[model samples]
Target: MRTVGNDLVRHQLHENRKWYLLLGALLIIFGVVLLASLGMATLSVVFLFGILMMVGGVLHIVAAFKIFDGGYRWLWAIFGVLYLIAGYYAFTAPVQTAVVLTSLLAIALIIGGIIRIINAFMFKPLPGWGWTLFSGLLTLLTGILIIASPTSPFWVLGMFLGIDILFQGINYLTLAAAIRNIPPSSADV
Candidate 1:
């Protein structure tokens, strides 16, 4: 028995099921292609990041002029300039950019894992605290391995991106299948 909200969601999903299917197929193909050409994919990711940083810089500069006032305006402008410089560096030296980004990712993961472990201990009285600690330990180990691995900076980001896209495509495919299974009510016709 479906609630009204569930029925409505089903109806909407059913209506857009084809789009989901198409997106899923496209993403899956792209993910496979990325995984096949890891080096190219890595460079592509770096280029995309550069483009995003440049776009952000432009937006920040625009905001400084159009939205911010007084000291905020200067701060925004300064940030915009910094973003632009970083973007330029990313574009000019993608390999270096990847190394820097990978290092940052490892550091962030380590910090996040430590925080989670601490939180798990703090919440020891709560159920599932053990799972939290386990997850934190796993994350910490992964970060350590990434930092220690020689190949990490070259392909880790691309590999992660490919896997993420693959999972997302699977998710969409599953959603589409579920939507297709939904029964059409009289109102749908």
Candidate 2:
């Protein structure tokens, strides 16, 4: 029986190779720029996140009012208010926000990497599964290093983000190559 990874790779190779290539190229370009301007890029990311949070809070508050007859509306309203406070803080204290956000990113990376590794193992015997495992391990290690050093440079956040994206681009390129190299029929276990 072919694993889900085999079917996914086959489908992507046959149907979305161009999209994969485009995404990989775009990520690589963006990653390079972020790495080049680590401090500025980190500030930009924090600012953007703040703006998004403010917008989301406003939207949620508006939506809560729109839902006239539901108890859930109150829950939404509370969340909206909390979001507003958080968003305001983010804007007012961007450097602190960046640090907190970076910590959250590290936690997310750690969790996501663990999940990916487990998923990769589940797709065993499939072609390129090792690549997925390797990517997951890298991600896990990066996250651990970030968490271990809270007093690192401010630019660490941006550098980490850039490195993560670069790896993602490489992973995409690697998957594309693997899919292109192996025929669908040959992927079956």
lDDT of 2 by residue, 29-115 (tens): 889999998987788777777888888889889888996448989888888888888888888998899889878878988998999
Residue pairs in clash, model 1? none
- lDDT per model vs. reference: 0.88, 0.81
Model 2 CA deviation exceeding 4 Å by range: 1-34, 151-153, 160-189
- lDDT by residue for model 1 (34-83), tens: 89888888888788889999999999999999999999999999999999
TM-score of 2: 0.63
- Estimate the TM-score of every prediction: 0.91, 0.63
Candidate 1 Cα outliers beyond 4 Å, as residue runs: 1-9
Best-matching candidate per TM-score: 1
lDDT computed for candidate 1: 0.88
